[model samples]
Target: MQETLFCLRVGHRLPYSMSYSNTTDFTNPSTFILLGIPGLEAAHVWLSIPFCTMYVAAVLGNFTILFIVKREPRLHAPMYYFICMLAITDLVLSTSMLPKMLSIFWFNSREIDFSACLTQMYFIHCFSVMESGILVAMAFDRYIAICDPLKHSTTLANPMVAKIGLAVVLRSAMLILPYPLLTRQWPYCKSNIIPDTHCMHIAVVKLACADTRISSYYGLFVLFCVKGLDMFFVALSYTQILRAIFRLPTKDARLKTFGTCSSHLFSILAFFIPALFSSLTYRFGQNVPLHFRVLIGNVNLLVPPMLNPITYGVRTKQIRDRLHQLFSHKDI
Candidate 1:
């Protein structure tokens, strides 16, 4: 069955109006109008408040994690290194969309340059893929530490960590490179108005006059290859970690060991669950309200960045201790 395309008309209050004519050769409009949550424009102001707060929190939290990790000698380990990478990825992922989205909500600054939109699309998806890979790396770090304590240091040396980081970067960049390239080639003559806040891949590509099956299929392929493989490895690592924890000599030892993994487990759930749900909902939930769908999309990107640092700060003893010491010294 062919996917049904829904064309949204810009409301009268929008600064720029959209033309839904049947023309097929416009290729690239100079600017694409972003309609921030169709049918809920009136609440845009109120909505911006929470969105802005989350963006601010995300920035501050991630930067704090990076600062603490960098300043403390004890944190110069494989796990902390991966944590820093995750923080950076979260920052990029949230920053890519929140500012522009806040502008749309607060000032009606909804017009995005075509090329710029594609660039934003690329960054958002690319970093999201990187985040997934980093999560897997973090999980591997946990597995090595718990299951193979004696060789953990030798197995995940600085050189090995560098290699893992390089692989994650190259993998995401190479896989998501095709999205903008493929999207740019299509003729977007159908409409210049995107129904949601950001230039999501499908949302942007669907506007093109040409068949979008190629982009859609490639998207699925990347989704499976990156996120799918990452999830599988993470699950396998944790499974082994769990078995090791159980075989420990005593109950207290089991609890103590599991505590170390609790933070990573929380971060994984926080990152992937909403992300997968939002993507699936956007693609298949035809009966879902536009506002609800858009809100989920924003939440997946916004919430994880803000939540990850907080989760680590509270759960990781070393980070919490460093945070306390750093602040206490300032108070003196």
Candidate 2:
């Protein structure tokens, strides 16, 4: 009991603890403490309601979309397949973010082992970039479907969709694998109290005693290559899509064409807007309240997954028809 007490107290101090701090070189720390949204400790119970709601909705929403798409013959198109990939990414993202966060908010269970923390960071980042890639692919799908409607089937055939899916997965895994490994190589000496809800790459990297410039720069490089390139292509594709939409002779044709993109546009905005905002806030909003920063940081993870499926089900006619057939005991 005494030994356990000693370890807990020491582990709470992390690499800064006396025994661990004596040497600059270190193997691993006892544990990392995740501070769940600073200044919200008193309201953790109340805050967990929304977190739990979002988590459940995210899981259900994504899985429902996946099931409907997979089971229905009408949804076998490349667009739906890309959406399935997105559903999978949403599953991973919500799984990566919510479990530990809920545990912290509900049970005050904050301590995480070193290997687990690294693993969590790996999945979180990998899925995030993969989702970004899928969004870009979705944009291309929209562009082809709208601008080159006659060639849509040929352009995004099953083989092409499979290749894109494989590429997205491989790219994400390759880019994000180094992040956890980099953090693993660096020794933590200051503290292990990560002032965030989950094991984020930046949060963990910032705790290392070693020079983090390489890791930081490498992160930024990956960020620009994956998300930056994705956004650029998406913007370009939409530019072409808009150009095609306006060229249509009838006003009804323009509205019909524009309506087809509403779901994807909503999805892009939901995922990217909060994500970029939170990242900027994290980097530059030093004066911002920690709780506020934490909330914004988490918004993208929760909101997009819950909303994306609902948006598509409501906006896209094929999905809506398929869903209605599924629930109403009719054929799609």
- Candidates in order, TM-scores: namely 0.94, 0.91
lDDT of each: 0.88, 0.83
Error of 1 at 318 (Å): 0.6
Best by TM-score: 1
Which residue runs of candidate 2 sit more than 4 Å off their true CA positions?
Answer: 1-25
Per-residue error (Å), model 2, residue 110: 0.5
Candidate 1 structure quality by residue, lDDT tens digits, 96-169: 99989989988889889999999999999999999999999999999999999999999999999999999999
Error of 1 at 12 (Å): 5.1
- True-vs-predicted CA distance for residue 112, candidate 1, Å: 0.3
Residue 272 in candidate 2 has what lDDT?
Answer: 80
